[model samples]
Target: MTTPATIPTAGDEKLPQAAKQSGQALQTAGRHTTQEILTFTIGKEAYGLDLLTVREIRAWTDVTPLPNTPPFVRGVINLRGAVVPIFDLRVRLGADATEPTNANVVIVVEIGDQLCGLLVDTVSDILALSDDAMQPVPATAADADHNFLSALATHEDRMVALIDVARLFNRGVPQVSEAA
Candidate 1:
């Protein structure tokens, strides 16, 4: 797996001067202003979210069924010590639901103070995108059953829908029962 580079900190006056120069160079190169996005796939389509909102990625696992909940909600999972609700992205995207396969993954994301898992087909790499590369979602795209998409990003000859995590869970999520 490719890992992000760690920035070295300044602990002395000389280091601070070098760090300031490097920071200015980065800013001049437009690196500090560009937003990084983490992309993933569901079926054949690509989607993205702000890299800052992504908590972690995990392999698909068995989720405990919740009773009297919407069909789109798969169930809840015990993540570490917390109970996290998992949503099936296929169902939420108006696609027919299917069983999880070896390639499936769960993308844990933070929406405000709430954490939830999004079950997707695969996890792709993080990408850096400039503000000019993003465009408003077309009317047809905005009319989808899913209301979380805020914009569409075109990068590296591919299209990625930008999801708004906060808007997705602005309303209280329905409680999932252990028995479904």
Candidate 2:
């Protein structure tokens, strides 16, 4: 394997004497030694998300369906007086609409500036993984659903697809236009 190029840092001798000592030139170099993930199930598949992004996990609640939105958009719920859109994780991941039951749950997460809830079959467990345990999604996975998976991690004989919440919301899709 080829050695990666070394980025110049504030401590590098090549920098001007005064510039080398400036803290602005310090290279931001730190790896997450350990990360916590919130694991959930949709269908038979298990998935995970950065625990830091998850605000709360609530039992499944009936939502007020909105007209003219995508099928995957399950509609909004009253979250402490704030209307938060709830996305069906199954449908968003290209599966059929989930038939929510008492066991189902809604994972409230803050994606960007918006707070939305993801409907999942069940909240499984909290997983703690080291940085090295995360593997990049294969380049061959070019499907819409797979694109939302940022990484894969194995937990006790099962592989969990690590969902990228940001990408999950930002995927490019054809826009619906109103016709006169």
* lDDT for each residue of candidate 1 in 116-160, tens digit (9 for 90 to 100): 899999989888876567789777754645667988989989999
lDDT of 2 at 157: 92
Per-structure clash totals for the candidates: 2, 0
lDDT tens string, model 2, 1-180?
Answer: 999999655445354332243221222225234567899989899999988788899998999887778788887888877678889989887879998889999999977766788999989998887656778887775564468787899877999999878788785322322220
Which regions of candidate 1 deviate over 4 angstroms?
Answer: 1-32, 141-144, 175-180
Cα error, residue 174 of model 2, in Å, equals 13
- Using TM-score as the measure, which candidate wins? 1
**Model 2 spans with C-alpha error above 4 angstroms:** 1-32, 171-180
> If scored against the real structure, what TM-score would every candidate get?
0.76, 0.75
Candidate number with greatest lDDT = 2
